[model samples]
Every structure is written in C-alpha cells, then in structure tokens.
Target: MSKFDSLYIAAKEKLLAAKNIAMVTHINPDGDCTGAALAVRKLLLALGKDADIYNEQGFPSFMEFLRGDAVFNRYTQEDGVEYDLTVFIDCGNIDRAGKVAWVCEKSDFIINIDHHSTNPMFGDINIVDSTASASGLLIYDFFKACGVEITLEVANFLYVAIMMDTGNFSYSNTDKRTHDVAGDLLELGVDPSVLTQKILRSTTYNKLKLTAMAIDTLHMYCDGKIAVIHASKAMYNATGTDSSDSEGFVGMIRDIKDVGFAVFLRDTTDGKLVKVSIRSNLDVDVSKIAAEYNGGGHYSAAGCSIEGKIPDVEEIIVKRLSEEL
Candidate 1:
C-alpha cells in the first residue's frame, strides 16, 4: 500500500458520512485547484450526494469550459449556506481559502487535499503528498478508492489540472508515473491538441498587449542569472487588462536563456499589495523565497505577495534571488 493510503481511507470515511459537502480551493484558483475541486464534486454527485464548489475568486476564463461551471460559486453568490463536510484542495493552508475559510468553520469535518511540501496540514484529515504532481492526481486516486469509473468529464478536468501544473509535461515534476497517469487520461479520450489550443494558444488581444508591456519591463541582474518583470497598475489600465490577463507572464521571463531564476511582480487589484511569482530554471529553490513572504509552492515555481509598490517588491525579491544565486 502507498504511504497516503491510510489518509485516503480516513478521508473516505469522513466523505462517506457527509451528505452535503462544500468544496474550496486556494485564492487565485489554478487549473490543478479548479480541476481537483470539480472532479471531487463529480465524484460526490455520482454517489448521489450534493456538492457545492466555492472559491473566493472564481476560476480563469480558460477554465469555464470545465464541467460544473453552474454550480461553482463565489462566497457572495451563495445565500448563507452550510455543509456537513468542507474539503479544501490544492491549498497549502486553511487561510489559503481566503474569506471563505470562515464559512468552512461551520462544517462538522474538514479535509485538506494538496501536493505542496509547505502544506500546513490544517484539517481534520489531511491528504498531502508533496511528491504528487498535482492535487487533481490525488483526486484521481480518490475516484479509484471509491470504485468510480473515470468519466470523460472527470478525465478532461484532471487532464487540465495535470497538464497546466506540469507545464504540459515539460516541467521537472513530470515523472514516469506522471506520464503513466497521462496515458490513462489519454485512454479516456482527452485530446492534447485541442486542450493546448484552448488553453495556451487562445490568448486574448488585450492579454497579448499586456504581455508586450510586461516584456518591455524585464530586468536582468546577477550577471543575467536572475531576471525580473514588473507590471504596474497603469500598464494594466492602459492595456485594458486585469490580473487574469497577466497569467503565465512569468514564464516568458523564465525562458530567458542563462537565467537561473525569474521573478514577476504585478500590482494587486486593490493596489495595497504586489503579487510576486517566481520561476527557477535550476540551482535555486524559488519556493523557499516565496515562503519568506508568506507564499509557498514547488521548488521551481512558487508565488507570494508583499505589501508595497510593485517596484519595492521587485527590488526586495531581486535582491534575495541575487543572494541565493
């Protein structure tokens, strides 16, 4: 049996006892978080139970095509509801649920599902496997434990989760088992060509314009080992864009040849803080740097936020990366 088998069994027991379930993910829901939540909902629905998916901030536009879009609600969209069980997926800590974390307090049990090494295990039952490629993969296991077949919808959602988190299987985390899982997903008829076109290729005009602006702001330091990109509020306003449009902007900087680490800073919508994304080629553990700013993620990719101007956050992060490099 796997090391997490016991945790999965415990989680299954809690889920079986609960008739009404509420699910949540981290604050800026990514494909892995979004997919895992939806897949879990699908599992619960198949079991003849009610599942409500919640997010403080709804998913990105590319994810709208996933199943259960109608049932996915923001905290404000609900009319003060409660649940027998609250399941938090792809979140490192309970606080990662943002405002909705308080709503979960009403639940009789909480299950934390994640694949981050920094996960705090803040739940009545925690199923955390830092070695797993994505939380959606863990949900895939959950489906197996429940003896549910992997439907096309479930496969599609898990495909998006695994693909995005693995950078389409190009990241370091893509191992033999990861590919094995992908192979199984392919058998369920998830077309990689169509998914890539819909996700990575289908960029909006405004997003492209924002990307151009972000590229112009790139700064290389530490003899070109550390690269930085900053997006100001004015840039977003001028380009008719928002934080969503800035997604994947950090990858462009990380792609710079000879750059060991890359950092992207964007002014938060409320303008009170700067959101920082870090990507590393090798040698540096960006997650550690992110943890210093109350953020955490994988070794090669991580994110955090800082209270200050974008320039200030950029300066501090660049300096830190410089010291590490």
Candidate 2:
C-alpha cells in the first residue's frame, strides 16, 4: 500500500461527488501539468462525469503530438460560470494558475495535485508527494486506487508527463519506480523514439536561432561553479522568437563541464518582466533560491518571474544564487 493511498481516497471522494469538473493547469503549461490535466479529463469521462480543462496560456506547439486532434479548452478570464470542483494539476501554488485563479474562488471544491517540493498544500484535498518525480505518477497512482485501467491514451500523456519532468529519464529524479511505470507504458506500445523525435528533435530554425543568441550571453560566476545565460528582448526580436522559444536553454548551461548550477533569465517580449529559470547538477537546491522570488519547483529545476528590467533582475538573481554557492 502506498503512503498516498488515503489522500487518493479522499481525492476520489471529492471527484466522485462533483458533477461538473474544471481542470486547471499552471502558467506556461508543460508536459507534466498538461499530461496530468488530460488524464484527469479522461478519468472523469471514464467515470461518466463532465470535465473541461482550462489552461490560460494554452498548449505548447511542441507538445501537439500529445493532444493529437483534440483541442484544449482555453480559460479566457471569464467568471460567469461556476464549477462543482476545480482540480489544479502540477501547480505548486494557487498563484501559479495565473489568470484562471478566479476559478478557485468560484469552485465549490479544490483539489491540488503536484510533486513540487515547495507545494504549500493549497487544495481542500492536496495530493502532493514532493518525492515523486512527476505529478503524472500521482495521477497514475490515483487511477490504481480507483481500479481504473491504464489505457493507452492515458499512458501516452502520462509517459510524456514523466519523461518531460524527468528529462527523459536521464535526470536525477528518475528512480526504480519511475522506470517501472515507464516500462508499463512501453508495454502499452508507447513508441519512445517516435515521441522523442516529435519533442526534442523537431525544433524550428527560429528556435535554434534563439538558442544561438541565448548562448552568446553565457557567463560563469562563483569561480565557474555557477553558469548563467539570458535571452534579452532584443535577442528575441532579432531571432523572431518569444520566451517560449527559450525552453531547454538552462539545461544546456547545467550540462556545462564542472558547472554545478545554471540560471537563465528571459526578458519577456514586453520587456517589463523577466522570467528566471534555474537548474542544478550538484548539491545546491535551486528551488530554494527560486522560492525567495516566489517561484516554486523541484530541486533540480525551478523558476520565478520578476517584474523589472532584465539587467536588474539578472543582478538580483545572480547575487542570491551566489550566496547559495
């Protein structure tokens, strides 16, 4: 029996009692959050309930393969409707829901599901396991508790959920159970190579151009213990790309030889906000650093956003991170 069995039962009870369900994802939805959201929709449907996913930022084009022909329902800051329940998937904080946070206030019940180490337990029934590599794993466990079979459709979404957050099973979070669940997905005929090609190998030329530009700002700090990069608004303008195009830039820095920590500062297109992404390959907990800025994530990868000039934000984050190193 898993330690989360009781929590799963409580979540199931709330979900079972609900009539209309609203599934919400965090800002800048990623595979883990999006995948978990989709699975919840499928589960609600399987149980003969109505479920709708509300993502304020919409889905990423790179993740289109996961959705296939399905179109995600977008939350456009409307408040006329009310839901019996709203489930937050992969969101560490209610604020992470961005514009759609209004749903939480209107919903009769709230269920927060996540795996972030900094989660504050914001849900009426918070199903959070900081030790779990991905929130998709929690959804997987919930399905088991409900006696729901791991269908192929659910498997595809869940697989990518684990794969993305775990960096394709190569990150430190991948463990025996992670692999065991991935193996089960493989048995369901999920072609990993095909998905990998669709995700990592299918980058556009503009994205590469943005990467080249971000790489140009690379600098070392803390005697090469910390590596940093930035995608300025000018760089995005020159590359014809936006903040979304800067994905995976921090990981590239973290992979640098002998670099223990990596930070990527992205100046939003409007130039009024700078989003900070951090990753670490050593004992440093980057999430703790991110928390100081009101961001939350796992130890290996975390992020926060500051509303200020890129130069100022960069200096602020670098100095804080330096203290940790």
Candidate 3:
C-alpha cells in the first residue's frame, strides 16, 4: 500500500472517533478546496458525525450552485464553542487556512487532507498526494474506502472540483487516473453538460465586457512567446465587475498561438495587493515563480498575491519569466 493509504487509514479512525468536527480550506478558496471540504462534510454527516465547514472569505458566485449554504460558515472566533476535531482540506499550510488556523490550533485533533506538493504537514494526521489532480479525488477515495454513499450533490460538487483544477481535463495534470476518477464521478450521475454550461457559458454581460477590456491590454513579450495582462482597481471599478469576474481571463492570453506562458495581474479589494495567476504551455514551471512570493501550486498553473501596484508586479513577473523564453 502507498504511504498515503496508511495515513488515510489512520486519519479515518481518528475522524470516526471524533463527534464534533470542523472543516476548513485555504483562503480565497477555489473549486478543489471547496469541493474537498463539502465532500468530507457530506461523508461525515453520512457517518452520523456533526461536521461544520468554515472559510473566511466567501466563494465566487459560480460556486453558489454547489451545496454551500447550510454547511459553509464564515469564521468568527467564539468564546465557548470549540470543535472536538478540525479537518483542513486542500490547504498547503496552516497559514493558508487563514483565521481557521487558530481554530485548528485549539481543536483536540487535527487532520490535513490535500494534493499539493508543498503541504506543510501541519496536522496530527496528513493525507497528501502530490500526483493527484485535485483533493476532491482523494476525498472520493476516502468515501469509497469508508463505504459512504455518493449522492448526486456530492458527485456534482466533486466533479466541479476535479474539472476546474484539471482545466476541463486539458491541463498537464490530467493523467489516466484523473480520467478514471472523473469517469467514476460521472457514473454517480454528474451532469457534465449542465455543469459546463453553468460554469463556462453562463457569464454576465458585465463580465464579458470586462474580459474584453482585459484582453485588449494583453501584451506580447519574448517574440510572441509570452502574453501578459494587468487589471487595476480602476479598471475593475470602471467595468463594474468584481475581482471574481476576472477569473479565466488569463486563459485568453494562453490560447494565443505560439505563446508558451501567460500572466494576469489584478488588484485585489484592498487595492494595495495585486493577485497574479500564471499559466504555461511548455517546459516552464510557473509554480516556482509563484513560490518566490511565498505561494504554492501546480507546475503549469499557479498563483501568488503581491503587495504592489499592478504595473510593478507585472514588470517583476515579466522580467523573471523572460529568462525562460
């Protein structure tokens, strides 16, 4: 058996022993994080355990279609309520858990479940697999191992998580195992057509306009091998679009012919912080660049947040990425 199998077996026992459980994911949660948390919550509930999901910031509107309303909670430090166990899903490190890190610290036991190579092994028990495309995949395995039934809602959420992180099964992370897991989820009655239309096709007019504007600013570097776009707070305000609307804008640049790398920089709500998402098509490892800013993710697709003006952050990224060209 794999090392992760042993860890999962041990963690499952601890989880089964805990009655009151709390689940958390990283800040600014994406599909994988939310899916993993929600899947685990469903499994725990199936096992007659009480599980609560927590995250500081809310998810994007697209994710609202998932089962988040009842189970998902915003973190607030309460005096008297302490969970017997805290489970972290898809978080690379304790710090990535944001406010929930304190809750993890105070809990009687901690469980970390993730697929990131950079996971810090912060929990009393950890089940991390760098080869998995998404944490939802691991959660699926957990549910199967524990003989938990996979409901339609669970299947849909896990499908979204796997699909998004795998770039609709087109990214380098897509292996035969990823496809097999996705097929299993499909067997559980996940409607991919509905999910695709809802996630990829259903965008507001304002989002479309903002995306066009962002694409207009796309600049080619290194003889058309790299493309970059910057969206300042002013641009977002002028377009009347939230930061979440800028999601997938980087892919527009990456789609360009002969482009090996693409970068998108946008100022966050704080206006002082810029968020960067990088995508590469070839031998370039964007995660290394993201890690320079203390961020961690996959090799081809990675992101980092910078405390600087968009132009300044763009310049630094472009200068560093130009070496790869």
Candidate 4:
C-alpha cells in the first residue's frame, strides 16, 4: 500500500460525507497547484458532488484555458466563502494559500494533498508524500483507489500538473511511477506534444522580452558552477510583464554549460522585496538554502522571499550558493 493509502480512504470518506466542499489552490498558482485542484474538482463532480476552486489569483495566464468561463466555479479568497470541507492541493503550508488560509478556520475539515517535502502536515486528513513527483500523482492514485473513471479533462489536468512540476519529466524527481501515472493519463487521451506546444512553446512576446532583459543581468560565480539571473521592477515595466512571465527563468539558466546551480531573483510588484527561485542540476539540495531564508521546497528546486534590494539579495544568495557549492 502507498504511504497515503489510509489518508486517501479517510479523505474519500470525508469527501463523500461533506456537502459543501471547496477546493483551494495555493498563492501564485502554478500548473501543478492549479491542475491538481481543478482535477480534484472534476473528480468530486464525477463522484456526484460539485466543488468550487479558489485561489489568491484565479489562474496563471498560461493556463487560462483551464479557467475558461469558470465564473461561479473559480473564486478568490476575498469571496469569504465557508465550507464543511476545504481541500488544499499542492500547498506546502497554509500560509502558501495566502489570504485563503483563513478558510481553514471556517472549514470543519481540511484535507491537505501535496508532494512537497517541507509540508507541515496541516490537514485533518493529510495525503502527502514527498516521494511523489507531483501532487497530480497522488490525486491520480486517489482516483484509481476509488475506482473512479479518469476522464479526458481529468487526464489532461493531471498531465499539465505532472509534466510541469517534473520539468517535462526531465527533472530528478521523475521515476518509474511518475511515468506509470503519465502512461495512464495518455490512455485517457492526454496529448503530450499538444500540451508541450501550448504550455512550453507558447511563450508570450512580453515574457521572452523580459527574459532577454533578465539574461543581460546574468552573473557567474564559483568557476561558473553557480549562475545568477535577475529581473528587476524596471525590467518588468520595460517589458510590460510581471513575475509570472518569468516563471522558468532559473531552470532556463540552469541548462547553461558548467552551471550546476542557477538562481533567479525578481523584485516583487510592491515593497523592497525580492522573490528568489533556485534550481540545481547537481547533488546539492537547494531547498536547504531557501530554508535559511524561511522558505522551502524540494532537493533540486526551491524558493524564498527576502526583504532587501534586488542587488543586495542577489549578492547574499550568490555568496550562500558559493558556500554550498
């Protein structure tokens, strides 16, 4: 049995027992969080119940198709909604839900499903396994365990969630079981190339322009083992793009030759803060570095936010990376 087998049964039972159900995505909804939440909503509907998906922001621009005309189905935290059971998908902690964290108070039961190692086990019924590549795999297991049919929509949703989080299955987290779930999704009509074209290939002009400007800021340390790239507020204003446009900046630079660790620092929209994303291609755990800054993630990928000027924060992170490397 899987580590989450018992939790799955309990979650399934609670889901059936509850009438008012709300599915919540984390703040800064990525493909994994958004897709898994939406997939669960579809799963709940297939099980003879309806659910509403809420996020701090509705959805990222890249996955707007998933939120098409979701009028009533998609909601924000400002809605001040209450539910008997609230599901937090792919969130490491309640705070990751941003303002929507309050729903945990209004919710009698909270089901936390995630694959992040840093998760705090905040759920009344937690189905968390850091071993899994993505939360989509866990939700897929739940669907299989319940003997529910995985529809095309659910399959596609799972595909995006898994594919994106696994970096198109090229990241270290990809494993035999990851592919097993993906193969099952393919049987359910997931088109890999089409998804790749839509998600990976369809970068906006502003995003590419922003990337170019950020690339100009690239700096190397430790004999090129560590590379740092940044996007300042000025770059965003110049390119008419925000942080969302620069989603894969760190990973993109990590591919550069001789660069094992890549860091991307981007200034937040407001305040004197910089958001940091780190990715590693070596055996080093980048998440530990993020933890020192009060953030967390996986061994190979992680992030944190720092309160400082972007240049200062960049220097601090590069020095830290130098020490770690």
Candidate 5:
C-alpha cells in the first residue's frame, strides 16, 4: 500500500469508530470540493454511519447538474449540532471553511483531505497529497482502499470532481494516472460526452449575459501579458446573475494568445469582499500570486478573496501580476 492507502486505512478506522460525522468543504464551493465531500459522505453512510456535508456557500448554479444537492446544509452556526469527526475536503486550512470552521473546531477528530501544496495540514489525520490532480482523486483512492463499491452514483460524483479540477483533462495536472482513473470511471458507467455537455456546454441565459458584461470590462495590462475583468453589483442585477454565473469568464480571457495570465474579480454577495480568480499560462505560477493574497490553489489556476473596492482590487492585482512577469 502507498502512503495514501495507509492514511485511508486510518481514516476508515476513525469513521468506523465514530457515530456522527460532518463532511465540510471550503467557502465558495467548487465541483472538486462539493463532489469530494458528497462522495465521501455517501461512502461513510455505506459504512452505517450518519454523515452530511456542510458548505458555507452552497453549490454554484452551473453545478446543479451534480448529485446530492439537497444534502448540503448551508452552514448557519446553529447550536446543538454535533459530530465525532469533521472531514475538511479541498480546503487548504481551517479558515477556508469560513463559517463552518467553528464546527470543525468542535468536532472530536478532524480529517483534512486536499490536493493543494500550500495546505497547512491542520487535522488529526491529514491526507494532503499535492500530487493528486484533485481532492476527489484522493477520495476515490480512499473508497478503493475501504473496499467500498463504486456505484453509478458514486462514479459520477468522482468523475465530475476529477474532470472539473483537471479542466476537462486539458490542464497540466492531468497525467497518466488521472487518465487511467478517468477510464476506470468511464467503465463504471460515466458518459464523458453527456457530462461534458452538462458541465461545459450547458449554461443559463443569465450566465451568458453575465459573461458579456464581464467581457465588456476586460482590460489588458502589462502590455497585454495580463488580461483582467471585473464584475460589479450592477452587472449582477442587470444580468440576473450572481458570482457563480461568471464561473468561466477567466478561462474565456485565458484563451487569448500571448496573454500570460488572466484575472477575474467579482463582488461577493456581501459587497465587502471581492473574489479574485487567476489563471496563468506556462510562464507564470498563479498560485504564488494567490498565496500572496492569502489564497491557494494549483499552479495554473488559483484564487483569493480581498476586501476592497473592485477597481482598487483590480489595479492591485494587475500590479502584482506585473511584478510576477
């Protein structure tokens, strides 16, 4: 067994010993975090334990296609809820859990499962493997080690998790093992053609409007090396969309040839915070830039949340990216 297998054994032992379990993912949950958390919850349930997922921000609108939407409890700091183990999936640190961090602290045992290199390893059992293309990949390995059968439902969850995190296998993180795992999932009844349509091609009319608004704000800086876009509250209101609708806007700008990096900034539901997503070409390590703002992710894709006016935030980010280039 590899190191992850041993950790999986320990995780399995902990789950079997526990009665109530809470699986928590990071704030502004993405497909990787949501899918990993939900998949693990199902596996825990199969072991005859009570398990549920807690996410501070619920699923993005585009990810409604994934399974287990209702089971996610939007964290509200309610009292009297308890758990023996709290598994943090795809979160680099406890703070990334946002409002759910309190629950993680209250839990008797904590398990941190993630693929980010900057993870702080702040759990009783830390399964932090940066080499894994996605956290769901680690969860898949965990399921295999526990001898849990990969049902069609479970297979779809892991499939979406891996596919989204690897950027449909177009990202550098997608390697031989990633493809092999995807092939296994395909054999288990995951239809790539249908999944691709739902995840990539399918979009709401509101999302298209939001994309247009964001593109209108696009500005290239550092002599076209950096492409930046900003979304404001007015745009959200006009487009009948939220931050989630602008999911792929950064990637849209990233496709521009000769643009070394792309940036997307949007006002949070609470106007106090601006969420920044960064994507980079081969020339830059965007994770380092995100880390400077107390965010973390893969080298090619990363994000951070900043407290400032959107314009100021955009200017500061361009300055930072300029330094990086």
Candidate 6:
C-alpha cells in the first residue's frame, strides 16, 4: 500500500475515535482549501461527529455555492474553545492557519491534509500527496475507503476543490486518476455548467471594472516573456472592489503569447505589505520564487507577501525572476 493509504487508514481510525472536531484552512483560502474543509466537515457530520469549519476571513462570493454554508469561525485567541481533534486542510504549516494556529495548538490531535510539496508534516498525522490535484480528492478517497456514502453534497464540494486547484483540469497536476475521480463526481450529479458559471463566468460590475484597470496597467518584462500587473489600495477604492475581486487577474497576463511568467502585485490591508502571486506556464518554478520570500506552493503557481511599496516590490520581483528568465 502507498504511504497515503496508510496515513488515510490511520486518519480515518482517528476520526472514528474522535468526538469533537474542528477544521481549518490557510488564510486567504482558495478553492482547494475551502472545498477540502467543507468536504471534511460534511464527511465528519455524516459519521456523527461535531465538525466546525474555521477561517479568519470569508471567501469570495463566487465560492459560496460550494457547501456547508461556508461557516468559518473567525480565529481569535480568546474564543476559549478547544477540540478533541483539529483537521487542517490544504495548509502546509501551522502558521498558515493564521490566528487559528492557536486553536491547532490546543487540539489533542491534529491532522494535516494537503497536496503541497512543501508541507512541513506539522500535524500529529500528516496526509500529504504532492502529486494530488487537490486535498479534497484525497479526502474523498479517504471517505470512500472508510465506506462513507458519496452523497451529492460531498461530490459537489470535492468537484469544486479539484476543478479549481487543477485550473479546471488544465494544470500539469491533472492525471488519469484525477479524471477518474472527476468522472465519478459527474455521475453523482455535479452540475459542471452551473458550477462553472458560478465559479468562473460570474462577476460583478465592480470586479469587471477592476479587471479592466488591471489589464490596462499590465506591463511586459524580459522582452515580453514575462508580464506583471499591480493593484494598489487606491485601485480598490477607485473601483469600489475588495481584494477578493483581484482574483484571476494574473491569468489574464498568462494568456500573452510569448510570456512564460505572470505576476500580480497588490497592496494588502496594512499598506506596507504587498501580496505577490506568480503563475508560470512552464519550466519556471514560481514556488522557488515565492520561497525567497518565505512562501511556498506548487511549481507553477505560488504566492508570497512582501513588505515594501508596490513599485519597490514589483522591481524586486522582476529582478529576482530575471534569474529564471
């Protein structure tokens, strides 16, 4: 049996043994994180366990259609509540859990479920598969192995997790097993058209305006081999858009014919910290770049937060990425 199989069995045994459970994902959660947390929440509820999903911030409205009401308890030190077990989905390290890290520290048992290669194996039980498209897919397999029914709700949550993490099956992580799992989910009534429309095609007017502005300021570097864009705090105020609306803007630069790398820079709430998201089509390992800033993720897609003005952050990233070019 594979290591994942062993870990899955051990984790399942623990789940069956636990009473109160809490689930958490990384801060600024994406599809994989939210979907995995929701899927696990549903699965634990099916098994007659108390599972609560916790995250510091809310997800974008586009992801609201997934499941479990996206009920995230804001992370705070004074909550004074602890769990028999805490399951962290799609978070590589404890710190990624943000303020919820305190909750994790208080748990009697911790389970770290993720697909990132950089996972620190911080949990009492770490079930990480670097090759898996999404942690939700692995969790789905765990439920299946444990003889849990694959209900429509579970299928929908897992589908969103897998679809988004693999870029709708366009990323290098897609494999035969990924397709097989997706096919099974489809048979179980995952409405691809509806989910796609809700997740990808639907956008508010303010988001559209922000996208247009981002596109207008798109800059090409390395002789058009790299593209970069920035969204300052002012941009959000001008467009009446939240930082969440900046999602997917980097992909637009990736469409540039000759560009191998795309970077999106945005000033965070602190104004002094700039969030840098990097996407690469091939060869260039953006994870390595993100690591330079103490961040980690997949080779093709990664992100980091830098303390600098937007312009300075942009110049630093461009200079660092030039080495890869």
lDDT of 4 by residue, 24-125 (tens): 877778889888877887778778987766777667878877664453233334455678999989988887877667777878999999988988899988
Give candidate 6's error at residue 105 in angstroms: 1.9
Q: State TM-scores per candidate.
A: 0.95, 0.95, 0.93, 0.94, 0.95, 0.95
Candidate 5 Cα deviation (angstroms), residue 183: 0.4
Model 3 lDDT per residue over 1-325, tens place? 3446677777778888887788888877778888777788788778778677788775556788786554567767878778788999998778777776777866998888888776778788888888999898898888777778899899988898898888889877899988998898889899899998888779888888888888888888889988999777777888898777887888888999999989999885545888898999988777778888987777788888888887788888889888888
Candidate 5: 10-residue stretch with minimal lDDT: 61-70
Off by over 4 Å in 4: 68-80
Q: What TM-score would you give candidate 6 relative to the actual structure?
A: 0.95
Query: How many pairs in model 4 have backbone atoms within 3 A of each other, for residues 3 or more apart or on separate chains, i.e. clashes?
Result: 0
- Model 4 misses residue 207 by how many Å? 1.4
lDDT of residue 283 for candidate 4:
88
Candidate 3: misplaced stretches above 4 Å? 1-3, 269-271
- What RMSD does each model have against the real structure? 1.8, 1.5, 2.0, 1.9, 1.6, 1.7
Displacement of residue 168 (Cα, Å) in model 4 is: 0.9
Cα deviation of 62, candidate 6, in Å: 1.5
| TM match of model 2 to true structure | 0.95
Q: lDDT for each of the candidates? A: 0.84, 0.85, 0.82, 0.85, 0.85, 0.83
Query: Between which residue pairs do clashes occur in model 1?
Result: none
Error of 6 at 45 (Å): 0.9
Instruction: Report the number of backbone clashes for model 3.
Output: 0
Worst 10 residues of 4 by lDDT: 69-78
